[model samples]
Target: MVLYTLAPGIRLSFNEIYTSSWEKGDSSIFGERMLIVNFCIHGRCDVSLAKNRYAIVKENQVCISTVMPTKDFYYPRSLYEGIQLYLDLDILHDENGQDFLSALGISLEQIVEIFCEKDGLYLHQMNDTLRTLVKDAWDGKDDIEIGTLRYLAVRLLHEIMSMPAESETETYFTRSQIAMVKEAETLILSDLTTRITAKELADRFGVSESSFKFYVKGILGDSYLNYFRKKRMEKAAELLETTNLKVIEIASAVGYENQGKFAKVFADTYGVSPLEFRRLSK
Candidate 1:
């Protein structure tokens, strides 16, 4: 387990877990009253709350739980890997934070209801935007500093409370199906030079074309082509900022055959052309 204390009210933990079969532990939530968001980046685990009551947090899923200072929660761990955040919601009452939350359509009472009241453990598959944001939070990428993390935690609360009802796709998907989707993602990110089609990926993974597309859409919150292009564009930007590669070389590296088209997309994504980005970075 790796931990980061970004502030007094916010702490982040990234756990690379390998426990004995059926290992058990007492979660310190019994003594802490805070909002917790756990992202199961890989693997899964079951959390036992009260007698004969439990919640299973699946892989690639996220959960929000509110802890009571006097309640005991048991974790009968299987192999678990995840990133978790501890957020002291009381911090929001300071200054104009509550007002800021209200502007975002969230109120302290609502937050309390979602995080402090009821059974209080909620789980859902993250939409692509939130998925990426959580990953950035773990990777310490993009400007996810202490202040940004606080903002993200608040935004996360908004998302959790506002998410729509579960669809059939979310309600049921086998581990094999999840693995197929992850394999497809691996293939997409494997080679930036090659143009990979959804059909080709489906065929490679032995899944039907439509089902593969649907699964990718459900997990990534975008069409496969759109997501792939976004990743490629991000790669192009990295090359521009870190290397002395020419525009044509960068474009080619990102699977763009036409430099002009690449320039247009890059400008749209970064508000400047590739050369300008490079110059600014330097």
Candidate 2:
């Protein structure tokens, strides 16, 4: 993957590969505060963010609005590749921000609330103009790339924030509920290597252990430990495929103390020994 900072508060990143499938890899935790918008330009890949997993992103499709400290993977990968744009919300405090939001018919108050709530993993229906802008970003247009991406980003955000609350009434997870989950997810990811117990997580959210587990299971369909392991394993897999790091080294990096246990878990999840997986991947 190659990352380019297109402007002061915006960036473009992408990777192109020709392969039957992507070897299982580790999830990436975003440390900086920014909103990420990803466009799958060429092929398909599964992206797991927060507690939710996106299985297939095809050409011209987009995944928008994820906060930092999230996990993701690309799956059943066939020459899978795409571009990601990161935008700093602070930029919206200025005239450009106002103009952009105004054009999308979103109010300043709504934007503030959305940011305060820290929403995650929002997918928007794409229109022709939005689709074309994403293509332009991937094509590396020098003259208008940054402006186009920023414009599209704001437009998409407005569309999401402006939708009638009633329209989402049937959704199992409300906007507030989604925001809370994302907040919990962010806390969990902030320190992936640390030992975080259920009690601690519940305390942080001011909820009972049962409630926390229920929320996690209800939205993510898994317990907290299972979700964390998936994220760690996903990150470990990415390192194995992209680097020449030793197995022991990779194990330690992903928070494993016993190499034997790490290898066992990795093999079970991936259906191959770590060494074998690495060799075949290359």
Candidate 3:
């Protein structure tokens, strides 16, 4: 993939139909101080950050990230392409920008959570109005026309943020609990290669092991290790679909040293082998 950095603070990086293969086992620390807003225009892609993983960011889906020192990769490899909009906090606070942020119920902390949390995909219906706005900007013939599209893009982001937060009942974790759980998840994902025990995690979070276990189980209805394993497996699934990496390599990247055990667990969780799942996705 071709990488470019537009204007230092506020810029748009566009890549059209860029095709490339991601290494089987690769991870990097994403630098900080920028907001990444990606739009999937032509084909599908997946990204794994921390412990969360997303698949097939279909056309029109927007994925935003603010955290740094993380890893991301793509899968399915179908002409893999998209646009990355990077904005600094200052640009996001312009008069018009302030209005947009208010509309989305966005706070500085919430923006950080959006990127650091596992659920990064935000789905919105592409109605006529939205479609027309996109068409005018992306299909426009010149720079001046394309610049006008930025306003519409801001409005679209507002519309997305304005949508009610997903119902709490729909998620096993309550809103407050989710924040805490997400913080814990970030820790787990940051170093998947190491062995982490529940007691150690509990101490780090300043709670007794029993209380920590209770908190995790109450929200996710599962033990800490189980939840951690699920997150790793989810990351593996994304890699399997997006990269040409072998199953063993993917397994190791997500903290599994035993490929056989990893395969069995993955198949049981997904109802199909990783190879089979990747083939079907393609």
| lDDT (Cα, tens digit) per residue for candidate 3, span 1-282 | 333333234455445554322442312213345456666666554444443432324566555655421333443322555555555655445444344444545453465454435453343334455545555555642354333444544565554454344412221323344445556766777877766788987788776899778777654446887878887887898998889999888988888899999889999889999889899889
Tens-digit lDDT string for candidate 2 (83-128)? 6665665554455644544555645445434533434544434557
TM-score of each: 0.49, 0.40, 0.40
lDDT for every model? Answer: 0.65, 0.59, 0.57
Candidate 1 residue 86 Cα shift, in angstroms, is: 8.8
RMSD of each: 11.7, 11.7, 11.8
Model 2 residue 215 lDDT? 68
lDDT of 1 by residue, 1-282 (tens): 666666555676676676412323235422245676778876565554433334456677877767332222212222466777766666644535544445556564565575446566667787876777667766764345656755766676566666543311323344566557656766666778888889998898887899988877654456877767777888998998888889999998988999999999989888999888899988
Which candidate ranks first by TM-score, i.e. highest? 1
Ranking, lDDT, top scorer first: 1, 2, 3
**Any idea what lDDT model 3 has?**
0.57
On a 0 to 100 scale, what is the lDDT of residue 219 in model 3?
46
Clashing pairs in 1: none
- Highest lDDT scorer: 1
Give per-residue lDDT, candidate 2, residue 23: 40
